[model samples]
Target: MDPKTASNLSFILNKPHDVEFKSRDLPTLSDPHDVLVAINYTGICGSDVHYWTHGAIGHYVVKEPMVLGHESAGTIVEVGSAVTTLRPGDRVALEPGYPCRRCGPCLSGKYNLCPEMRFAATPPYHGTLTGFWVSPADFCYKLPESVTLQEGALVEPLAVAVHIVRQAVVTPGQSVVVMGAGPVGLLCAAVARAFGASTVVSVDIVESKLAFAKSFCSTHTYSSQRIPAPENASNIRALAPNLAGGADVVIDASGAEPSIQTSLHVVRTGGTYVQGGMGRDEITFPIMAMCLKEVTAKGSFRYGSGDYKLAVELVASGRVDVRKLISGVVDFEDAEQAFEKVKEGEVIKILIAGPNEKKE
Candidate 1:
């Protein structure tokens, strides 16, 4: 077969908020297990903004003009010979990571930790922020009729929240405190409620974001900036008495130092605390408080094996109203402005339509 040549428009990151529309060759399926998708919508993520501004996130650096989106949904236009689960015309959410199935982590069902994982929008690996993207068939989950392409695009981040909830092992009648009202934090609160948490508190410095959280899932909202920094656990207990009074779990989606510190202080002894966001690689944590409380701390990476499936199910069943989180939709030409909105912390989730004529 001859090599298929096609043009795809992508958001290229040259610097912070320095995104430009560029034409690139459409990617091809290198293996029989691959599938090609015509992207419909992609969401602006925090990591994408970090890469645009800093050119790197931790060890992953953008050495070339890399496409800048991972959370996406699209229609399958082509399928490889070995692919049987998905077919042409199927609308699906693209799971951005493709791991080497032979790796220890992958074989153990923890593919998110696979050392040889090739994830989109993560330096070196081109992302799905384009007119067309090609991915492994197994990673493209079919969307049900109830799920819209916009909601499908949001499943990626929702899966992250699901994974955090799973890691925390939240149970019914428990209380959860999510430290961030960003997309992930809001989703975490939503997922926590869906998972049967009796009370979920979402905290953030932004009052508008907190209000948004309340509208979606949070039972309680706190503007952390308004509260004085706790000098110790007792101080935190006083400030957040209701939440600190024996909360079962605390999820830190903010990735901020103060949030992390407060999570440890607010969680009851022997309760779980999961770090769902990536902030500085290292931060000054209150180790003494964590040890004294015997807090169980875990760092959550991206979604693992069952997370994407659960996220899709949540959207399909209407358990998670992902569409409510979408703040605005922009055309592919205005994709840069979408990223700017996220950078300015002005939007919750901005969905960028693929390269197509604008709908009337």
Candidate 2:
């Protein structure tokens, strides 16, 4: 049980609802610019839970046992000789995905769209759940002294919201309607608010989530009531009376078909609509409504360059408070319990203390 000689203990998923703690080889720097991080905190993501219960998400299948976690922050335990931006003992958020630098999307700074991206907790790629994880120095965003490692773990989802809101091009004085008051939806509302949107309304079927969204970031909230998309849209518009007719931008953070359909009706003419959630690969769209409104529909994948950086800034500056979203934290020994809590709708967001985490 010596500190330095301990193996790399990882929480791995062998199949749906079948997970185990296995010791893997401690990760080492793969390049001169890579750094080895001792993960301190990790957030339970929806994708992680999906892989746990379904063993696959879309095309990404867990053909083999894969480490299960990606949203993480850790202390750099060692750095390669070429790493100058980060060093040993530095606290950083581990950006789980890295692309081939030679890709066109990468050269254009749209690495999130790169064809050959290796995203952790995704198929064929190990995640940051181990005692030690390695990542390129540039991908590991350094956290401000004021930010806790647990908060740093939130950068991943916050960056996701950042990308979605940016895709909508929300401007100051404009109104935005975000469908689905989950973590991403709630954060989308917060990010839009931070972007200076005059009114941000969060809509959801659950009254509790709507209640949380109202207090968390949104200027207004609406209950979907399982009505027709247009009726729901009209009710949502009424919540943001500052908006003329409808919202300037609409975002679907809930991949539910009804939410997606409502988003199209929620946006005003010539406004933008961004789909940030992952539902079915195919869904029916209201093409007529889109054409009539001339709405610009865009799909937001994952975060790209500057998204994570801005997410950190938004939190560090108190513009977007991620701390309010966190519901609880559990030690690494109890990581499975954290997943179960999220699966059962018991918490908003939960963080897992990394193996060997130092207790305060």
Model 2: per-residue lDDT, tens digit, 1-360? 233785578999999999999888777667998988888889997899999999999889999999999999989888899989987888999899999989899999899998999999999998988898889899999999999998999999999999999888889999988988888999999999999998998888889999999899888888887688888888777774676588899899999999988888888999899999999988997889999999899999999989999999999999998999999989888999999999998899999988888655
Judge candidate 2 against the unseen true structure and give its global Cα lDDT, from 0 to 1.
0.90
Question: CA lDDT of each candidate?
Answer: 0.86, 0.90
In angstroms, the error of model 2 at 232 is 0.9
- Alpha-carbon runs more than 4 Å astray in model 2: 1-3
lDDT of 1 by residue, 263-309 (tens): 88778888999999888878997788689889999989999988999
Cα error, residue 91 of model 2, in Å, equals: 0.4
**Per-model TM values vs. the true structure:** 0.94, 0.98
